[model samples]
Target: MQNVTIVICNYNYGRFLAKAIDSALEQDYPATQVLVIDDGSTDGSREIIESYGGRVKALYKQNGGQVSAYNDAVNMLETEFVILLDSDDLLYGHAVSNVMRVFESGNFVKVQFRLDVIDPAGKPSGTYVPHSAAPSDCGSPLRQGWLYPSPPASGNAYRTSALKKIFPVPEADINRYGADFYAIYGVALLGAVATIPESLGAYRVHRTENSGIDFANSESNDKAPKALTKRWAILRQMARARLGIELPLSFHDFSLEKAHFCSAVYQAPFTKRWRWVSRQSHSYFRSIVGNPFWSYKKKIGTLALSSLCLLPFSALSDFAVRYIANPLARRRF
Candidate 1:
């Protein structure tokens, strides 16, 4: 295995933080090192982190959210690959070795693996996300379309070179609010990603766990939409300034896309909803058309809806989407 740095960021998770550190320390990879950042936890986190002595390096700072902690970690890491872990989660013993086995000479910006859901007591929840195996090298982003439903942060491994290309991410709302969106999505846009087919980690579901970007968490419900908007805006800005690629998508543009896909936006305030769909319909129409991942039949249906975006038939379109399109498509969020 290559020289890798496992970065575990912690807040008030003192009880579970030790297991997370132990998991990183116990990695069988010969060249692996552990760095733990205690993000200004009021709890006894410092004592526990200090207890590790020289086995793990520790960085202590005020609680500035995950983005701040992540940015700090990246700035300090000189390793080839960085694996992020959460304080409340546990990494399988072979996670690092398995991910490194697939790291060949390629343009893979990152490697992500699935996580098994576990309760507070660490019992299995019997649910696996993405529900599909992608063990082989995925040359491009999973699909050519939009980067929706990004993989979880802790289970992924990213190359340092790839991250430097997208560093100093604009600390907009999403960067401050969502933990992994800025890095994950930015890296995905930069190059291809490889997904390990096996489950390499456990995501602890509990009330006290710092629910960074989880929408199901009670605190994250309201922050999700605003965070998503900020993420889209930053992507557009980066594409223009750094990559010189004029993006076909943006915050408002995605609003139109989501409306078409979910149909539930019709229930939103009329002027706000109408303004977005009307302005972005043309862009949305073209964006979804040439995407091979989208079926010709679905394209035809969306195109038809786009044609009527400016009209007063949004209520009907919304009805079709909320009642018919989503049910028929069976897309999981």
Candidate 2:
């Protein structure tokens, strides 16, 4: 059996830490190794990690955010494959086994699966991430500067060799929060990715004072576009340096445009929201029309949904903003 390591990174999430660790330890695969890294938590997180004893390899480090933990985890990984589990999320008992099956069947750099969204209380939210499977052929869209649909960190498994080339990601401010973005996009640039169309894990979503869960909030919506824009630039640079492929200078993804639209609609004053939404709607129309990878059905569906934003009435525009533009609002809990 191929050795696989589950690196669960924690930072003051002691409330939800044990369940994450237990999920890793309870994987059906015997060769699975569970490594829990505590990023300088003050809330008895280290104690929770230590309780696992020899069942898990526990490493405690000063608080350095998610990417830093990823760097530390990658440095110590000796397994053939690794899954970076968020301290708050979980893996199904067969997650490793399912991922191994895909890896054995193909020459893939990364294996991505769906994630069932859960509340902090661990109740089902009746939603799954990505809303669709990742395309088998990512090269075409990637070269066109479009990032295909992918789940968050816990929903991915990476080949150690591919990860070794991708990390240690630059410990810059922009690269701090979303380590999975770098891992997923970077590995796609390296080689092929296998997609498992079933949910193999659970992604916990909760609202804290600082949580970015509220997609309708202007600040949260604004940050996504900037982050995604910067993320594409960084990935483009990596592709040139590592793969010698020069990506298009302009990046266009429906998700990024959605973020911009959401931010503008929510942030703009009432009198100006219509104008801003109209502008973003035009951008969306252009994006949908220009994307060669999208099928006519998808393009028409997207274009039709975005056109609702240009409606003169706030009620209709608000409905479009909530259901169509904001991804989080589409979820039914």
Candidate 3:
């Protein structure tokens, strides 16, 4: 392992803070430094962090959000690689050792791996496979750039030099929430990125985990416009800085996302296909229908309207899904 530094950026996650730090420090790989950048936590996090004493390097700052944490922590360390571990997540024991195996490659900014999805109690519920292939089993030489099911923050180990282009991430409204998108896309823009085929970390699913525009669903309310505005700003930055194209972005529409998913379901065999329909139907139910983000009326209205996609009529199904579900989803956003 090449003198890796795990920057466990945290905020108000005192409940799981120590576990995150311990996982990093307990890695079998030697020469691993654990740096906890606490963003003005009020939940007794300071005490737990302080308990580690000099065993872990700690930094305290006002509630400036995640971008600041990474921006500050990266500048403070000169290590070759930095893992941005979330305070609520855990690094699999072999994470550092696993990621380092592929570091010697050239023209790559980072290596993204898989993470296990765990419950709040820390029991593994399911594996977060970035693709059907395993992390170690994935990533051919030419496989790079904008990987699908994008790797979670914890599963990534970034080349510090490559990060120089991404840091001080925009300082915009959206970036204030977190820098994962900017960092990942920015690095992808800087150079090629690879993937590992192992589940190297844990991503927690809890209420505290559900905020920001990424999780924006039916409940987002008027804030959706703000989120979208910031999103456009971030997208503009990525396009200009990375692609050198004068293009900007907007929430043009997501009818295509729904259309593509529905189209795939339409082509599958009925037995297998219903599963796809049910999954997305339930997804609409959960993300919009049962979503806490939506208003009671909007939730019911969206659900009642989107359910038309399940009708036996194909044209009606396609029209309802392509036009109704997606438009309602955006309005709910």
Candidate 4:
């Protein structure tokens, strides 16, 4: 059996599918199998995968969305490690090799690498995005505390046995959110995780992409308002499911920021709206109180920032950049 199984979930990204496949086929690691699962794309994506011939194992299925494709691929993996690569993304020259080398140390439950966001023209845009690597045995995956917001599974590698236990990827149940958050959270619940500092891949950001680009479209004015409602509801659900306690306003605010961003970008709700802006602001302040793990100093600072969120006057200032801010910015102000 191969040491690593690479799974690419293809949708309508015909233009970039070939490059993604080529990158997988060119992996420096030995004993690797590339599996391309096409989710019923009419955009010539299947043709691109077919052109690769024996270079990849292609599986064509109905247009069941990304989560469904991921569940299908995860079930089929027979290798020791599994990596998820989106069709529009590219792996660095030594990505597979770097991951293999790290695995040699034998100290991780899962490892997530860095991601570089690229423009439509395929030029490097000088943006270096990084996740907090998996939190090193961070306490209580279910608590109202802080944890790395789950790394992107795109360049992530998981031990086969470790992943099978969490399989089925919950495709049918997830509405707007993808699988990574649930996957990483489950991994943390299972064991320790590690982060690789080297950036081993590029995640393409363009107008055709669903998340970032769709939110900016002209007709989505009510998008923000509806998303705010959905986000709060999801957070309550997540908190209840994971920690069994309804998170206070502060935690709700912190969690809502993430969910809101996902809905706007990934779910693409229509027309930006802000009816729940005041309520969200209150939740933001309430999240900081009594939360464990966050240092008292940090909590105090967050409380002050949450105060800003509470003010009716600060909505425009905060709401304008709320969805786009990174984790630190969101918590800090």
Candidate 5:
């Protein structure tokens, strides 16, 4: 059997830590190794990690954020394949086995699967992430500057060799919160990414402030677009340096374009909000038309939805902000 490791990174999530660890330990695959990295949690998270004792290998470090934890884990892991599980999420019993099977079947650098969304109480929210299925081969779309569907960190399993080529990513604040963006995009440049259409894990949604689950949080709304833009630029630079692949400077994803539109609508000065909204709306329209992977039906539907951006700031725009533009809101229902 091939060896696989699940690295669970945690900060102050003591309330939800045990369940995440148990999920890793209970995987049906015998060769699975569970490693938990506690990034200086002050909320009794240390005791919970210590209780695992011999079953898991634990590393305790100061709070250097998520990228730091990933950096530390990659430096020490010798497993052939690796999965990074957030401290608040979970892996199904067969997740490791399924991922290993796919890895054995092809020369893929990454394997991505769907995630069921659950509320804080562990109740099903009747939703799954990515909203759209990922394509088996992403190179064509990627070359066209289109970002194919992908889930958050916990939903991906990567080849350790490919990860080593991409890791030790710059420990900046942007990367600290969005390491998965670098991992997913970076590895895609190295080789193909396999897609498993079924749900293999659970992603918990809650109002943890920094979790970015609450749509009403103005700070999160304001920072999301700017952060996404920065991450894209960083990935472009990393691809050139690490893989010698020069990606296009322009990129488009409908969901992210919508985010920029909503942010401009709410954050721009009152006197200039319309101009910002119009610019973002045009960008959103271009993304819909240019996307090669989307069907005509999907493109038409999204175009109709994008039309709502033209309305002035009122009840209709408010509706667009909540239902049409907010990714979290769209994911929830």
Candidate 6:
């Protein structure tokens, strides 16, 4: 049996951290270790973790953010794989067993499971979204991007070796908004990824959740949209330098892929805030020209959208992003 190290970072999620840790410790999988990094939390979170006693290897550190905690915890892993579980979430009963099978098979480089959004009290809100694949049948790489279908990196599992090869984690900035997206993108560019069909966990959502708030202002709603705009730029560059290609015209058309689709994240109300629209258009054009498949029609449309994107409301394709486009991406794998 291979060893698995589960790293959970908690800031002030005192209400939920205990349950999350308890669930991890109770995994049916064998040869597992749990590491809980409390990032200078003052909200009695430390006390609750301490209650876990020797069950988990608990580390105390200043508030360097989640990535910092991840960086620190990963260094202590002698295990074969690392599972980054959020402090506010709960793993499904068989999540450990399922992940262990994939790691032990030695064929799968990474695996992401379906996720359900739960409320603060840990109850389902009647919004049960199935993952793209079931454990028995892993989905396509492109479909993996639609797993979370949201901004980035909330519900996914990775091989420690592959993760280390791409990123050591605890990255320098600690301020990265879509850090998980960057990590997942790096993994996709470098290694093969598999999708587990079963819903592996509940991604808790609430006003006070670490992810639901803006890290900088800590109170603004713009944090997510701002992070996404930056991610779009990064992906464009990665596609050019690494893949030697650009995002497809199909990628943009999919943005408005009628009645419903994922790329619509670009449509947040704040998405049309001018700053993001300008930058996204800049990246989109660069991608269109760089993509070999971009036809004359696409070139013309890209130019048209670019011009229209600059205007408010009338040219507001961003609206398509928020309402129609983003739903498919909430858990983008």
Q: How many residue pairs clash in each candidate?
A: 0, 0, 11, 17, 0, 22
lDDT of 6 by residue, 1-333 (tens): 778888887888888888889888988887778899888999999889888888899899998776677666666667767777878887876787887777567566567666676767887644333312323222232323322232124356777765665444324463433456555655555456666655677776555322221111122344444444455455556555655645432232222122121122233344444655455444445444543334677556555644443455632545333322223223322
lDDT for each candidate structure: 0.66, 0.79, 0.64, 0.61, 0.79, 0.57
The candidates, ranked best first by TM-score, are: 2, 5, 1, 4, 3, 6
How would you encode candidate 2's per-residue C-alpha lDDT over 1-333 as one tens digit per residue?
889999998999999999999999999999999998888899999989888889999889998878899989999999989999998999999999999999999899899999987877998777787765677677678787777778888999999998988788778876777777789888887788889989999988774221222532123655777877777777778778877889887777767777666667643356577677555467666667876556788888777766665556766666666665534556531
Identify the candidate with maximal TM-score.
2
Residue 305, model 2: Cα distance from true site in angstroms:
2.6
Which of candidates 1 and 2 reaches a greater TM-score?
2
Candidate 4's C-alpha lDDT?
0.61
RMSD of each: 6.8, 3.0, 10.8, 6.9, 3.3, 8.4
Each model's TM-score, in the order given?
0.71, 0.90, 0.67, 0.71, 0.88, 0.65
lDDT of 4 at 258: 34
Better model by lDDT: candidate 4 vs candidate 5: 5
Clashing pairs in 5: none
What does candidate 1 score on TM? 0.71
Query: Poorest 10 consecutive residues of model 2 by lDDT?
Result: 209-218
- The reply for model 4, stretches above 4 Å from the true place, is 131-133, 143-147, 170-177, 207-255, 258-279, 285-333
Q: Any idea what lDDT model 6 has?
A: 0.57
State, as a TM-score between 0 and 1, how close model 5 is to the true structure: 0.88
- Candidate 4 per-residue lDDT, tens place, 105-221, comes to 766667778877666656665554553344557325434434454435676778777666655544444333355544565555456666788788887755322323232211243
